[model samples]
Target chain A: MSVPLLAPGDRVLVKDDWPEFRGPAHIRTPHYLRGKPGRVVRVLGGFANPEDLAFARPAPKRVLYHVVFERPPLWHEGEAGDDVLVEIFEHWLQPVPAERQAA
Target chain B: MSTPARPESLARLDRLVAALIAKGIVTESDLVEAQARTDRASPEVGARMVARAWLDPDWRRLLLGNGAEAAEHMGVSMAGAPPLGVLEDTATLHHLVVCTLCSCYPRAVLGYPPSWYKSFEYRSRAVRDPRGVLAEWGTTLAAGCRVRVVDSTADYRWMVLPMRPAGTEGWSEDQLAALVTRDVLVGVALPRLPVALAAE
Candidate 1:
């Protein structure tokens, strides 16, 4: 019964220079989103942490959030036509003031 | 079983299943249930869901609100799988799904994902170039429409409830379901009213 983290439509910042969730693991957060700014779209529900699941270890459930990122901020190469919504874990995210958007 | 090229992988899978059974993590009945679930995976299930949604406003509201529940109501077992989210396509907005980290899919309702869905190029580019990718797939939206790319980076899997096509005033649910394809369910393609049933 952990407190739910990050509600829908809250702006959050992905930590900069944080190490990628390493292999020999089942991490679901994408590498490209590191240090990026996005808004939480919704709380996707709690699931046993996959990093522990990879080793058959008992995992405490963690809240997963669907965060929406502007295309231009994520990748500069392609046409900035769509907003990319990624399902990220609560541990990888931190809430930010709406005015201070980018990391 | 039709994937003959991976005998080694198949053997490895057998060994893993055997070990799971030995460890009491899963039983023979569990294995059978898993297989039965996979066996039932087909685009027909997705088509039926979409067709039902199109025909019934109450069903449509439920499907849009809780897709997994809607699937279960029709006997599509979603137990022990990720939550299902249906993104409805509209005149102004469209949705496309990709698993940038790995392949997370709504397997219970939509069956297996297409090979291209797991490719590195699709994973990397679909987020940035949805319109371009859809264009390459022969689907192009008209002016003023916006596209949204949903990355399945976690256990929350998404499927598209494609816009109901034009024509066919008196088509049956099965007839409408026939027009729904894996491509349409994934949002790369849109269902078209069969040419034979062209409307006035």
Candidate 2:
């Protein structure tokens, strides 16, 4: 699948999907960050799909993104202004819906 | 240092290695060479890079702009490893690194990840309560300084270029590198002027 690359400053939302792979699927996204809103911090370029590498299959390259999230929204006790940056693959990210973005 | 592998786990690994060797998938020499390379990997490699960046502005730009290339320039072979990302800590911002899914680290530069780094407790708390985790490690940042936690969740491995400690104005690169420990590189602790020097 050809996933469009996201640029810095673009707001994106992480997908909240769970893999039902029987064995190890090598999904790198942490469960907590799933479905969270974040801003693209950097375009990290492409890397071999780890999911395919884990199963020793022919892995296609996928674009990776460095996305930054605010701490307060992630945790109740999280201090304001603190940020969390997560490296996410293009396939797992979606454009933030208009209504979902905070004004 | 990580905990020693349990005997059963070790035995299982041995069986796996034996099976691979029997299938001609891997040779004993390949395993030996890989072990040797891992043993040679150390935090000093990262410290040296930090020190050089402190002493040289151009070097710092290179390190931050392209960490893997910078490492290769410094004679650290990054063959077969994913790209390296250096997180710069500034006066108003501090950077911390963690791998939530597994123990993915900048092994080429900082050697193996510490046992605590791979613990479930750290992985959970780092994202949930980073300030609390830093406090436990005795690294208290300024009240207004934002702590940016960088999760090395995907293909990129990250290391912190900790802010240079005060009171070391005329120090050499070697001297500066000495102050940067593994904890400081990982952002669990901040580099500090030694107590004696601070008192002076």
Best by lDDT: 2
TM-score of 2: 0.93
Predicted complexes: DockQ each? 0.71, 0.86
Residue B107, candidate 1: C-alpha displacement in angstroms: 1.0
lDDT of 2 at B172: 97
Q: For residues B1-200, what per-residue lDDT tens digits would candidate 2 score against the true structure?
A: 46789999999999999999999999999999999989998999999999999999999999999999999997889988889999999999999888888888899999988889999999878877888999999889987899999888988899999888878899999899989998888999998877888899
Off by over 4 Å in 1: A21-25, A101-103, B1-33, B198-200
Query: What tens digits encode model 2's per-residue C-alpha lDDT throughout A3-32?
Result: 556788888989988784565567888888
Which residue ranges in model 2 land beyond 4 Å of their true spot? A1-4, A21-24, A97-102, B1-3
TM-score of 1: 0.86
lDDT of 1 by residue, B1-200 (tens): 23456889889999998999999999999878978879779878888999998899999999988989999998987787788899888988889988888778888888887788888888887877788889899897867777888988777778899888777557899888999998898888889766666644
A2-76 per-residue lDDT for model 1 (tens digits): 677788878988776444334355556677888888999888788888878877899889988889988777887
**lDDT of prediction 1:** 0.82
Give the best candidate by TM-score: 2
Error of 1 at B181 (Å): 0.9
- Report lDDT per candidate: 0.82, 0.89
- Counting clashing residue pairs in each candidate, in order, gives 0, 0
